[model samples]
Target: MSSSRGGVQPLMRAAELEKMSLEQLKAVKEQADIEVNLLQDSLNNIRTATGRLEVASTALHDLSLRPQGKKMLVPLTASLYVPGTLDDADNVLVDIGTGYFVEKTMAEGKDYCDRKINLLKSNFDQLIEVASKKKTVADEAGAILQAKLKQLSPSS
Candidate 1:
């Protein structure tokens, strides 16, 4: 919500809300819609991250059971696969982010994958929590819009 003087306020008391014009009410509704959309986007991102983490965890488990120097078709993309053979089975490349890589033992790589999964799960949970709160705010804004519209209705 914004005050008459143009500064934005996060929440408006009931009395302050009484001062809002129809245009301001509409603007508030718009802002709430925007917030909901942004939250939805964040939720989608969390879903994607969670899915990738699940796949990583599974891949790590499968790798731990494979024989050393096992031949496998490595995925380059959704449709592309390249013939590849594992090296030591004891040594693996771990990505630390930003295209950087580090060498680690297989056990260490698996542990790293587990830690990454846990961190992503924690983050995903937080996003869901925040999205739930924003949903409540969006619902309230919708109710406010409805009330304001009723007050301005011809039957009012």
Candidate 2:
């Protein structure tokens, strides 16, 4: 659950929505749209994190296969790579987030990536459920608003 949505009120029921003024319905619809967008953004971020973790896991597997003193191009930046030789294939530095890195054995690094990927996947599944509910609420509110508008126009 996202802390950002802690202050948001629950969506009104369909029966209650019918009794709201035009302006009130519009407000509810807008709020629902905003909430849905936020949840979608959260889902996207989780997916990206999962992808990065999977890549790291693959890299760890590849590194474990290489012999010591193997020559390689170590990336200093996206486009900048410097020639280097493998120092310790058994041990690698793992980024634990918040600008921190911890040295761990290759097996341990792979395990960390797997754990993080699983955690992110679980969170993504939960967020998808929440986002689906929010979409339903938004759709219902929009339908009600359109009906109200049609009632006012009468010529359609």
Candidate 3:
């Protein structure tokens, strides 16, 4: 039967799907699942990076608002805080990766965060596009398997 929403359905018949071995169908499903999972992991990484960029952007903005020479609690470690004063609110230390830091003006730091956030979001969008294609393949394979199963049933 032709589906109301489409002009033509898939050409593969139930009989053709039934001819395919179960092992092959299962393999296709497994491979598709693995690819989708990897893409999801990458998306998670992008999300984490986005959060970090946002926090950095906010910190820079707050620093710019603070009066010069204002004493503040500086984080030396995750749990350790050191007494420090905001000597130059216009300057900031930006980590450029591999434990290397660059001293930049407040505006520069914000710009850096904006660039990183945009890059991460771009990666996230690309991953989503790829994952959607993988999911479509996985779904089609699943449909074939279901069709074959239905053919094997006595009710069919």
Candidate 4:
């Protein structure tokens, strides 16, 4: 039995070896808990980053593929105007591709895509940072447990 700090008997086997093994196990368990917490935080960060990327991707697609009303020109038919309509003939308009408005709209879309890409990259960076730290902590904790278990083994 272990020496009691008070007058009461310690709630453990009195053997020294058993006490040492119990202490080591307790330490290992604490380390395991810490490692688990770190890993969970890392996973949360990665999930957040993935969600942000998906949202950005969806927004980009929506903006780029948005339908601009019907582009077809109205059919040219004599019924569209009076048979002797000389004023309509003088006021007809033709389609000229690639105007200033189209260029401005395309430029806006490009800017939006670039911004979303940068945001996604930032989120991924944060995820990597957390994951790397978590991996390092988990590796160290695992090594400590392995070493402790080896020491406790009878064949060691």
How does each model score on TM-score?
0.78, 0.90, 0.81, 0.38
User: What clash count goes with each model?
Assistant: 0, 0, 0, 1
Across residues 61-99, which tens digit of lDDT does each residue of candidate 3 receive?
888999998999998976899999989988889999899
Global lDDT of each model?
A: 0.70, 0.84, 0.79, 0.46
Query: What lDDT score goes with residue 142 in model 3?
Result: 81
Which pairs clash inside model 3? none
Q: After superposition, which runs of candidate 3 have C-alpha atoms over 4 Å from their true positions? A: 1-20, 153-156
Tens digits of lDDT, candidate 4, 1-156: 212322112122224223345455455345544645765676576566556546644644544454444232333452463323122211223222254222234345445546655765676676566545544544544455566678879992
Q: Which candidate is the best by TM-score?
A: 2
Runs off by more than 4 Å, candidate 1: 1-19
Off by over 4 Å in 2: 1-12
Error of 4 at 91 (Å): 26
Give the lDDT of residue 134 in candidate 3: 69
